[model samples]
Target: MDLTRTKALPIRHGKPKVLKMLLALALLLPAGFGIPAQTSYAAGISKPFPQQVDYPGMIKPSHVTQNAMNKSVSDYYDYWKATYLKHDLSSLPGGYYVKGDITGDPEGFKALGSSEGQGYGMIITVLMAGHDPNAQNIYNGLFKTARAYKSSGNPHLMGWVVADSPKAQGHFGSATDGDLDIAYSLILAHQQWGSDGAVNYLDEARTMINDGIKVSYVTTNNRLNLGDWDAKDALNTRPSDWMLSHFRAFYEVTGDAGWIQVIDNLYSVYDQFTAAYSPTTGLVSDFVVGNPPKPAPEWYLDEFKETNQYYYNASRFPLRVVMDYAFYGDPRGKAAADKITGWIKTKANGSPANIKNGYNLKGTAIGDYATAVFVAPFISAGTADSANQAWINAGWDWMKNKREDYFSDTYNLLNLLFITGNWWVPEGQAEQPIINLALNKPAVSSSIEGSGFEADKAFDGNLMSRWASNEGSDPEWIYVDLGSVQSISGVTLKWEAAYAKQYKIQVSTDSSGTPVQWTDVNSTTDGNGGVDEIDFSPHNARYVRMLGSERGTPYGYSLYEFEVYGTSSP
Candidate 1:
């Protein structure tokens, strides 16, 4: 990949193009929340846009493609959207489904299949929608349902009902029922949509941590079975590995060291589960129950059932576990993710019979199945540069020109975010064309000369620059130019401010000009200072700037550096 530093655009008061992508959440819809974006603006949506090509001489392919060894990020996004979006949440028959119709219990508390689903799906849809205006509705819907649950004392928080009418009898024990997912939802609301209520929701969720921990940890099995108020035990013993993701989210929102400790401790428990749950054939058992496999490894045959309980073979855990470690920097977590990734690549990829391969990355048949195809994007996005790059090369081959199974508001938007990290989906289209960015040659305008400022040898690139914004010039600013027009998707900023009234960011195509366009992506002004993210649809511009809007501490501006992400050679 290539990255280039282009000049900035001239500042002007001209109105930046008003490009708003709509989300599917009814609550997110403005007063008269309109129909789906796909139906409302298909004609206006652009054909799949391509990343800026570093090598202009590179030939343009006519069809979509994917890597032979790994899943393509864009294809995976399309796959996720095709597999989940557009389904009527109210129609899910409890926790089960046949065809597209609800055939089983109707009163299930499954969050995605009813009015409540508007909230559940909105959580995912809003994030996936990125900077699109459509995300507003999903954000609204998410809060609406979350408020309903919170007002009801969060009965659904305990778990979702698999039947119609909110009965708790049918539920799978996955870590998703924990506070982390809720924390993510809160972050999305406040960070993405700027909902004031989101913080209160986060606080309430923080208070409920003990309850979540109790419900998740107290269970004898590794699985955290889903349920309503009184009905907690519906053992759908499938194996999943999403525990750490919840931990990562907890750490991201709370900055609590205890949470990190808790996450570190789970690795041991995970090891135990892995030993008991993994079959010699390389596939981890999806769900475990009272019955033990006859002639099972003698070590487990006698007491294995007791240990085998916490398993669910779904896309969330196997993939998200890797993502959590990669993002959170847990050494053990990284090792575990490595093992699982290897298993998926070596074992799962060998299955020629399975169309999409089994849910388990290792390809071993654990039996339980689900529609969460977001696995590909998480894996693609989180992978190490070379490895992911190769997979990206191959995955594009598979997704192009393929028909999808589950199409929904949530999954479709998410697909876009995972690959490009930008959330714009040209109207009606499922997949966007590949984007290639110009190779970047990082330049240093100035450097802080000190041994302490030296880059960590372990780090890919040493801390290029660090800033501490304080009272003197409270709102400090940092700017960078990609030097060329490219389809930029996301920006990751780090801050070390102890306290600040507010911090804001602005972006533009002009270098010397004012930021005519700004997005309030996050805050480092108050609370725990850490990394923040701003995601936008792939846009053509070069100049980027981040500055403090308020001074919480006596120090002027507290900034580490700005890390820009895009599809280009570096």
Candidate 2:
């Protein structure tokens, strides 16, 4: 695959030109000549939706019950799956394409689907394994379809657009965002169901990443070019394509430290752009061009007049940048996320409903009306800071039941998964099975704030409920009984606004023993309030307690959950 190949005409986001000559030639070729056949595989669900993954350093909406969040994702996915996901035997036998809407289509270009939509469909299906029984079959079909419409420049990369015909002529070049998502989704598929199946998803992912993506899309400077047809343009790049989490996964799979360079380069670019262009808001433009990258000129890409503003393309910046923080605990990611959330919190006056559709780099709203495409990503960004808890809870309420077009709806569903903690890293990496032994266990606290703030609420496995100690009290504690002696390796404390400045994890072999001998397993003096996972050498105990010595706030020490993890005593 030649990385420097250029075409006479550049392809816009979803609109592409129809090559009549290629269509004529494609009709003469035999059916499925280049496309691979779909083979049966023993693909089973390993990590399913509502995995309720505990992202190491991320926060979720604490104002709503966990069940409500899970239900919101399922409900939106059902509608999105029905409306956009389409199967067509016109090209590959088992081919599926996500149906696209005709919004903002150029005059000559008819709306079908793009590589972007295919990538979104693939990712959503793979993550939705347990919830959607037919996810595997649909995912296989989507893979086949993406493969059938390979890019003319590089077969490993899917073409950017699939126009009216399902034949090869319908596909035009490639887009960077779609290719990135498609490659990342394959890694996810390999992790969800092992690569022993017919697809060998891991192999395909490596090919796409190494041969296709690295060659055609990634430039010599380590910045992502617009698409395969960009001819390695170094100056101009799409901001939304700066997917830090995806790049991290790429580096993990390929061991290419170049991906790290790419990550560092993009972070630098983000900081530079935010400092220079949006000092206060930290908002970036849709397309950034040149060294010391600045916003693109109006009508620069021939896409739209607002190409330089934070329009549809750049609206996804928050979700893309924040995932690195949520998954990998990157401080840079958190810093970037906090900027967006912080600015938006003030802009919306702390209301999710006031979030506009688009904005300029200086934080002026380009559009007045609210849309899910813009709101959803902001909600995802809000998860980075505990200060935005109320903001994100309001965002979830505003976005959960709303309906929009294909693009907006799909983005909404994806962001919803991220916001609710349903989206997770693939299994081959740091993914681990999470089990909370203290869930629904008998718990007792020294004191409570009121009638609703009971000790059992902390052990009920609900984020919306918590156990609160008496106001301004020190030496307050809460403990949970495991019913029998068990080995405890780690504990997670999801703290509320009234968090403990200092706390100790103490355990006893017997809850009813005389004096109840308690031994300290872990102690922390600088305990910050978000989500803390304290790990230690395994200890056997029937009773575990959180003893607070100091309070972080004026109120009591409140905890949303007290989770214990370990194997049973043997």
Candidate 3:
């Protein structure tokens, strides 16, 4: 299996690019209640209507600002537009395109599979098609790769991996989550690009929905199985695999009543969790069992004795639930979204910076750092709850300069796109641009004394290069000044061997004076090399600095790059 065999899921929040073909400004009522008429842009295509949250109180004081969110979204898209799309997505020898995230491998990525890459590639490509000129071609390439790895048992279901050989790295089998997203992305692609040219988007979506999804969906209990191999029994469903919004979309497209039942059953699972494990908090677990699945009471997950806790897999519930609200405004969806917002606000003291990694179903922290992936989805939760505005701001702040990897990067950008209002709704939908709304924010360090170790290199918007401290120095610092007092979430430090082993990330409002007033936002005595993305409570400051006290090796503290990012209510 690949290193990324178990992936975090996307739920609660939302996807899509706008098209102008469906019912525009018409009420879409399900059974009884009528929702607000979904309005389309001048194009008159009926995509998802844009939604707004009524943040209570004065939205001004919150450090999480609109401009900050915009800046975060813009900076991230620009950084990833090239890396994930242009560079990382390369053509394979088999004439299929693979998006490879694994780097610096001794075996040259031979055993690495590319199914996850194929799925995400298609999703991102379709989303970026409006801005990217070569998006369609790239999507076609990725689709080819997906087809190349077709599962033998179920032809429609793709083999979970695509390695050097057909049998290598489980390339012979399939996984449920990737295929679901890939099919859903194809549906969005149909709406975004239309069934035209050489490729018929609508027809292809139908193929995936019928041939792939229909064939694999476990019919007896109205739930999805793990994959083709799973017996689709009571004890088999992965909670992370349940994406309610995608199920709804599936119902809409296929007119299959079973899909709706699947969604209803999923919500039932949510209800069961509230009653059994976490009543008020409503936290979901990573895995579930039985029909109308409930969390495993006495199960083990890695280090967690209670496998039902919200860990890597279940962190996506917020993202998934919020999407249902963002698009359909389902009351159940709103309730689910509120569970996370209320829980985080109450548990983390109303700030995402305080939230820790993983938690028991009863709302107990599993003693881990607040990761970018965990925080990103909550931003979607904030979209449904205006009271979560500040928290949403804090979440976006955490995404700033978030290191791009297979999992966190994917979730971060999706969360960024949604929270920042850059993600679109298909058919007559409008989207804000993903760009730095914050003007020229110059980056400077305490000192620069070398050819390659320039202070500005860290913030040059380049992935490579850095600011190395003067050798023999115990205390070295680098900082970024945002021209004005802005809401900041945290900073990302990419390090080499001579990195910070002990450091203090601090901020200051006044850069001048005898002793510049600085406040420590976050500190680390055990700093890991690679991408060290750290978050803090929302801070309003003009200056952000990384003060290193000790180095990882004999050499001075060196940073491949240092980045400051966050959002504000503005």
Candidate with best TM-score: 2
Residue 545 error, candidate 3, Å? 72
Angstrom error of the Cα, residue 184, model 2: value is: 0.4
Q: Where's the lowest-lDDT run of ten residues in candidate 3?
A: 12-21
Give candidates' CA RMSD values in order.
Answer: 17.4, 15.9, 25.9
Alpha-carbon error at 545 in model 1, in Å?
Answer: 43
Q: Sort the candidates on TM-score, descending order.
A: 2, 3, 1
**Lowest lDDT block of 10, candidate 2:** 20-29
Q: In candidate 2, what are the lDDT values of residues 398-430, reduced to their tens digit?
A: 999989677888889999888877787753332
Against the true structure, what is each candidate's TM-score?
A: 0.45, 0.68, 0.61
lDDT of 2: 0.78
Q: Candidate 2, TM-score vs. the true structure? A: 0.68
Cα lDDT tens digits for candidate 3, 433-512: 12221223576766664776777776653322456777767788887777777788767676655677899988888846
Tens-place lDDT per residue, model 1, 70-103, is 1333344445445544423353321221112211
lDDT of each: 0.36, 0.78, 0.61
What is the alpha-carbon RMSD of candidate 1 to the true structure?
Answer: 17.4
* lDDT, ranked from best to worst: 2, 3, 1
